[model samples]
Target: MTDTPIFQPGDALASARRTLLTEAQAIETLAARLDDAFAEAVRLLLACRGRVVVSGLGKTGHIGRKIAATLASTGTPAFFLHAAEAVHGDLGMLTAQDVLIALSHSGASQELLTVLPAVRRLGAKVIAITGNPQSELAQLADIHLNGAVDQEACPLNLAPTASTTAALALGDALAVACLEARGFGPEDFARSHPGGALGRRLLTHVRDVMRQGGAVPRVPLSATLFQALEEMSAKGMGMTVIVDDANRPAGIFTDGDLRRLIERRGDLRGLLAAEGMSRNPRTIAAEALAVDAAAQMDEQRLSQMLVVGKQGELIGALHMHDLMAAKVV
Candidate 1:
């Protein structure tokens, strides 16, 4: 029988770290290799009227999915279509207006090559990303991007380690370039990813989540403290807006105010709303983005903010709870 190899803890850990560094280096090399072809690919995708369809097999499929997601989220409309599935009628997803980016390290994935004729017949331009420029797929493509790696991180040199990572990084580069070329902004990204964290940060404006007029509890300066409590109870907003004679927001009275007033055994009926309400309450603009409001609230340690117009009129009110539900917090 063959002898079993001895394991050294330090040696094994060091080897793994070296492999990770090698993968990182592969990505950097791919970045340096980018040329006019990368720009041409971006232009082809932006000119597409339908979508960018990414196809791959094996580990390449995993990277393809991520690349498609990044492209879609960043403004380039794209989706992943398994090479095997394309032969099984999924090819219907592609159209003349679409562009196809096929991924394969060897550039000889059987499923991919089988659909090349149909892909061309549909008038869809194919961009091949592979390690071999002389491969059949590369020769068939309208454009080819070289994603070669000198060696893999795997000691056996059999696993797709450094090569797959390089491909993924290259895909990200393409996505970002296309995003910039399209002038896609945060608002566009938000629209594409409405359920994601980025959407909450960019699309959730103050007007969408803020409590509006009539729903906001408020009382005149001449009203008694007992009257403010009744208003707060009825509105269920946990606070009452204090407005000036011109209906401008003066300050606010909250649950904390109630606690302080209660601690002093203050006269609930005798005190006026102007006396009990805070005069320098935190406020935000009705047009302010939710992200900015969240930052302001965190910096000031305030639980809620009064939304006002340019004239300081009480337009709406926002609570920390609204931000929490919107996932902006």
Candidate 2:
């Protein structure tokens, strides 16, 4: 049976700290080593007519996958191709207009080396990221990015720890530079991530969530307070909009208003909706973003908002509960 190492909390903590420090230092060193070659690499990627293909093996391959995803999400067309897969038949995925980013910390991965000549013959440019500047991969590449680290963070100084961290940081720097150069913004990002929260906030419109047609709680301005209360109860929005003959919103009456009116006057006698309602209520365009509507509600401390059309006519109603149900809150 193989003996397991004894568990020592102190030693484990020390090792963890050392690993973090080593990886952090590796990234710092990579940043300091950036030169005109990095700019040229970014230019090459930007000028490419086709997609960016990233390839690597083992631990570096994992890093390459993440880099490709970052590039793709940030408005650069990119994908990852495993080095071993490329040597087999996946090289066909490459086109003359494409740019290849090959990762090999040793700068001598056999799989990458085997695919390099064919990639070159296909008329695609190559960008190599390796720890050794004098390595054959670096020499063969059209542009070389130095990802060299002082040492690995492993206790034995053998495993790829600090080196992988450096490579990832360098890849991230390249992606961010391309993103900024392309003027990629939150809207563009949201388009690519439609299933995420930011996409919901940006893409969902007030009309998409606001209650429309007969669902909206509304009444004529000349209606009695009891009639307005009936409309609010039927719509279940805790509020009712009072509109004029033109269907333009004249005022709003809420449960809070009803409570205050009863507390002040204590009379259930002939009160018009106009006399009981609050005038000049807040209204939003149906085309406005739901997140914007949410923001307005928060700023005004409102539980409900009226939706209006271009001609100041009532079209729908929006409530805080609707925003909550849509997850736009």
Candidate 3:
């Protein structure tokens, strides 16, 4: 008997290409179908007085969790609840003022169907995202947004491929739409992602991470190099800003300069800050974001930078260590 042949290289490549094209087509179909139902769903969610309760099962549950996270991070308060878990007592998390968004490709997820009635009975608004608008979950919802795809990207047409992607994209659209309607800003996004780099960039200002006022390692130009070194040691910032009599930043001295001076056998006690410091050192505005200051430090190849006010007066200092501690870089 002849053995069934395995897929050849050309066949495998063709199959992958077909799958990608199929999924892309499915996404296009889903996008074109978006309309007023999408708007209504956004309105219902916005009108909600409490958190959005997202529920689904199987692959839909994974999609639901992402949708909930997107909603939460984009200004909407939301959380995911497994429908099966909800029926097993997690339903207590839902409240009368909450809005329920149920995800099911068939609009007939048995677990969601089982607990959805309870969600509605509790006076929560129910919004369903499913491929079949005529399916039971859609019929039960107060608002229904079609997440229909033309077909599955799976060759067997069984696995949740194109359908799942379509649903996930639709949910993202809803999140962004609601986010725009609420005028959600970077600060609001940062609040939801406080532990991430984007959050640090948006929330960390110079004031939050700078060595301020007396804590800044600063000295007048007339101060001896020994005094500047002492100030740098006391502040533990590895550098010192040299200011003029008017308190304007005139120059900077770092550990590197001190090393160079020592190598040249220069007397640390006899040299003044003006004679030893690097004139017109790279500086940042006091109001600059910590991330911007970090970039400036990187570009200048410096471990520390001076923070100056509008009139170029030294207000504080930023060190690479401070940026690292604040996660600004």
Per-candidate local distance difference test: 0.90, 0.94, 0.88
Stretches of candidate 3 above 4 Å error?
1-7, 211-216, 219-222, 226-238, 243-251, 254-271, 276-287, 297-303, 308-315, 324-326
lDDT of 3 at 176: 98
Flag regions of model 1 displaced more than 4 Å: 1-8, 213-215, 232-239, 244-247, 254-269, 280-282, 309-313
Model 1, position 117: C-alpha lDDT score: 88
Better candidate number, 1 or 3, judged by TM-score:
1
Using all chains and alpha carbons, the TM-scores for the candidates as numbered come to: 0.85, 0.97, 0.81
Q: Pick the candidate with the highest lDDT.
A: 2
Query: Highest TM-score, which number?
Result: 2
Q: Which tens-of-lDDT digit does each residue in 1-329 have in candidate 3?
A: 35987868999999899999988898898878888888889999899999999999999999999999999889899999998999899999999999999999999888899988898899999999998989999999999988888779887789999998888888899899999999998888888888888888988898789889789888887899889988989988888888888888888888888888778765666788667678888888877789888887888788988888888788888889999988787
lDDT ranking of the models: 2, 1, 3
Q: What value does the lDDT take at residue 15 in candidate 1?
A: 97
Error of 1 at 54 (Å): 0.7
Clash list (residue pairs), candidate 1: none
lDDT per residue for candidate 1 within 1-329, as digits (tens), equals 34998789999999999899999999888889889998899889889999999999999999999999999889888999999999999999999999999999999999999988899999999999999999999999999999999889998887999999999999999998888888889899889888889888898899988989799899887778888889999988788988879988777888888888778766676887677678888888978898899999999988888998898888898888989888898
Q: After superposition, how far is residue 27 of candidate 2 from its true place, in Å?
A: 1.0
> 1-329 in candidate 2: lDDT tens per residue?
34987889999999899999999999988888999999999999999999999999999999999999999999999999999999889999999999999999999999999999999999999999999999999999999999999999997889999999999999999999999999999999999888889999988999999999999988997899889888989989898999999999999999999998999888958987778789999999999999999999999999999999999999999999999999998
